[model samples]
Target: MQIKHAGCYRVAVVMVLGMLACHTNTRPPVPGWPEHFGFGKTATARQIDSLNISIAPDGKGLPAGSGNAVAGKAIYLAKCAACHGETGAEPTPNRLVATLHDTARTKTIGNYWPYATTVFDYIRRAMPFNAPGSLTDEEVYSLTAFLLYRNEIISDTLQLNAVNLPLIEMPARKYYVNDDRHGGNEVK
Candidate 1:
């Protein structure tokens, strides 16, 4: 049959061909392979537990330990001073402590992070730069306390535990807004 709209007919033909191409399975599964293609072994409960060390802002996953700035200072000096400096105010890119009054400088944990628990979480997850997860729970807690104390958020003697860590209000918390938006077309 003679085509009237050649462009429209060509587009429709391409669409149908594309749909058929998608539906047809060009490659069959390997004979001995399982449903998962036998790529990786299933993770054990212990394996999963080891990796599930993420701490929430509300101090949900904080391990059983407590520390103060006094203890934290020693840990920081030994582990963190090389990168974050002795006072955590060196000219490093990611400064842990900020003057708070200096608005011109980059955002430090004291002036940027919304929650105090985040300090503990980050320190626990990735810190010391050289050895990410080398610090123990007590050491991590102490480091967190030290950072908070250096940032002027907490006193030198104030002990930080899971319960009190979440309660300590961050200075920048008021500036940040919670992202309550659900899945939608909105870019923000």
Candidate 2:
């Protein structure tokens, strides 16, 4: 095509090149390409179950286990006492023990956590700082019981299980407001 100006001709050529560059490649995969690296074996069902530990506020994902403050104390002493201290009264940022009655205190699991199931979820996901995601479901439930007992939220005799754990309402739950906002063109 004839162009009146050299600059216009240059612009037309650049636009054509840009459109070509933007075209998507629809070629198939090269033959004999490696699909599997064959480095690690496939994960077993049991292995996937072990890592799929997640507890909801309604205790939907809680595993089959039961624990009380009495049993939890022993487990806590062995695994958590090193960092949280025997009574969880350690001055670290991870302090787990604190009562709502204590007027002057830091935000603790007892007073700050909005859901009882959260205690179990956090312990199962990340605890025993040296080894994260290493504790079993039973041990995690036990630790949750111990912390709740120490904070005066639950009695030492109260057994924590999938059913009862969610029923136990947290003191801080009242302070939290749920976000009921809808998405997709709705005003936030």
Candidate 3:
């Protein structure tokens, strides 16, 4: 009985030691960087262009089609009025148009956006806040048209798209100038 008890104790001790040994404090080695970061393959220009829809400030990548402010008003009431309000007043606290105080005082679309193309560009990228990039090109154009019209920047009958978008000049266009500062004691 004593011999059997001693053998059991030895076995239990060995098991515990084995478990302790198995639990090491070492971490695995970090993975090395890839040799070719997946840019060796060339896609067709058409294929690349399909994915790239960014429009420049000069209206470079704008699609064909036009929308008038009158048309835009209906679309705005349907899709945007809930958030941006009936007159872009922002009843829910997201002002799409500037207040009277904002005009000629600070940077609102009506006050300081340099070009109308920016409005179209921004709406094309992000608008309707909750549902971004969901508007059709015509819908975006219409929204831009409506906002511009509401701001009294353009007439309701005016059509807006790529070709005509750049033509609608912003009131604050002349005030902006490039920052000439470089990194030294002064910041650029």
Candidate 4:
């Protein structure tokens, strides 16, 4: 009986050790070479900097530059026309302009966007669908101005800049209500 008890103790110890040694995390693999993976390299600062950029609705993250709608027209024709059409009057769902009204607004920039700076931010980060994030700050400002002008929200000669972009209010600004979500046991 003593010998059998000793053998059972040894077996229990071995099982616990085995379980501890084989434990693993169940989450998806991180972006690094695991113990068995030896092919990929760690991400560099430059690569991270270029890819990790976001802009807020209050004109934050806007690059320094200025451009008028007149100049933007040329750039738009060359890079944006394929997707947005020449006059922003395309039959697309998010058409930039045409027959704007309070009840019949088409959700275009002039009608729906609350801040003009958002226009610049979106264009700078993602435009020219084929090649995004390649345009200079000047180009983005120009495009923003052009879109504003096409919707008759701004004059064709008005130059847009970081300083003034945030001040231009959209027609539908009164309709949007900010999210009052706060963390915890409360539901927004």
Whole-model Cα lDDT of every candidate shown, in order = 0.81, 0.80, 0.77, 0.76
Candidate 4 lDDT, tens digit per residue, 23-64?
855567677848456677888746754675555566554556
Which parts of model 1 have CA positions greater than 4 angstroms off?
1-47, 178-188
State the lDDT of candidate 3 residue by residue for 96-187, as single tens digits.
Answer: 67634453343467766887888888887887778998999899899899999888888998888677788777887888899898778976
State model 2's lDDT. 0.80
User: Lowest summed-lDDT stretch of 10 residues in model 3?
Assistant: 99-108
* lDDT for model 3: 0.77
> TM-score for all predictions?
0.69, 0.67, 0.69, 0.64
Better structure of 1 and 4 per TM-score: 1
Better of 2 and 4 by TM-score: 2
lDDT of 4 at 24: 57
Candidate 2: tens digits of C-alpha lDDT, residues 83-176? 8877886767768887677763779977788899999988888787899989887888888998999988999998888779999988888888
At residue 150, candidate 2 shows an lDDT of 91
lDDT winner between candidates 2 and 4: 2
